[model samples]
Target: MAAPAVVRDLREHWAPASAQEFMLDDVDLGNRRLTIAGRVRPLDDLTLKLLLDWLEQRRSRWPNTANLHLLIHNQTADTTGRASSHWISAAMRGQDAPLEKLRVDRQLEEALPHGPDPLHLAEVFGLDEKTPMRYADSARALMERPLETDPATSP
Candidate 1:
């Protein structure tokens, strides 16, 4: 509730109307990839492990349920529907950082390493063209900034 805008994507992700087939399309463990916005993003070992664990729990808790969503709560376990929007907010109520900040930080992290390749950043993070360019520019500026001189050490 504190950061409502930050959880907009979470709401959409947990929306009851989300296509079950897309959940399958989103993850490919064999290939270690995640598809977001039609972009195939590679999954690191840690992410794969966490996803596997979640999948195991989901299967164990709701083995008899018909819900096919990647994420579901008790309210949705018995049906093909998903958890409600309030559930999404409550789930993230005590998070250390806002989701939007995490997303921006991730983009900045990617941009800092490859500012010269805005296209790659855009593709990797599933971002629009301009956003990546802004990140790339900010990263380049940070990298190219001159170091401050120490008066005490001046010759």
Candidate 2:
């Protein structure tokens, strides 16, 4: 039997491409869709983040890098033109209004230049540029496991 394909640790087999720096903007996650500066097809935000993190890591190691991207749509109004507040509420489980609008830009900043922030990822994983792919992989894996009230913090 052929040996199972060994998936190399992204850190080991990863190398950034010699491509121009691609700009990512107007990212709207309200509906988990994004409209990249120039591209097509609505990409999942989580997927984009994972790829971006990997690319950034590779870039740090290899200055010359190439990147790929796809445009996505954030459809706020539904097919019937109804507000998504009801859906959002149902998703939040009657949580505080402020909590519902939680976007952790600052939390992401803290998690960078060191390593993953267990405290932040413990709640929700953000595929922001600051995150590392290895960290993201671990965080996503942990989602399946039982939640630990107390999570480790980045030093």
Candidate 3:
């Protein structure tokens, strides 16, 4: 028999995990306010995208020297409230190492200056929105409900 469909899946069940590691501390982008989702658990696409934009924007505003510093810097913690400290550190030290680190940081800094932020990373990468619930409450509220159209009722 086919495996039971994963019950809640990413879209239905799953709550955000609240840890200091995943908390978004202070992210200020001029007059524009970015809604931070998944403070408690892994972030969804909307959250990740906004974060990438913010980080990249910051990276760009600085000179090449600062960019280089970011490339070499080992981030034990993300004061930016973007991701868990462990994830951030791992990503920094992961394969492609400095390049990956630079890319992530650059993404965040670049996103900071923009308005409305970009669509979440999930939408971009085509990943399932299987994020934990930490952001769900907020996400549900923010997203517009799809309008239901009855086929029997002609437009």
Off by over 4 Å in 2: 1-33, 36-79, 94-102, 109-111, 114-155
lDDT of 2: 0.33
User: In candidate 1, what residue range of length 10 has the lowest lDDT sum?
Assistant: 12-21
lDDT of 1 at 112: 77
Ranked by lDDT, top first: 1, 2, 3
Question: How many clashes show up per model?
Answer: 0, 7, 31
* lDDT per residue as tens, model 2, 79-109: 2232233332233344353331233333333
In terms of TM-score, how similar is model 1 to the real structure? Answer: 0.72
Task: Write down the RMSD of candidate 2 (Cα, Å).
Answer: 18.0
Candidate 3 local lDDT, 72-142, one digit each (tens): 12232222233332333333233444543443343344333432134443332222454212233334434
Q: lDDT for model 1, on a 0 to 1 scale?
A: 0.63
Which regions in candidate 3 have their CA more than 4 angstroms from the true location?
A: 1-39, 63-155
**Which residue pairs clash in candidate 1?**
none
Q: How many backbone clashes does candidate 3 have?
A: 31
Preferred candidate (lDDT higher): 1 or 2: 1
Better of 1 and 2 by TM-score: 1
lDDT of 1 by residue, 1-155 (tens): 23223124333222323322235447799999867556687765666776677677778977887776676667777878755545555645576876567667766776776665789877776667788788888788888899889999989
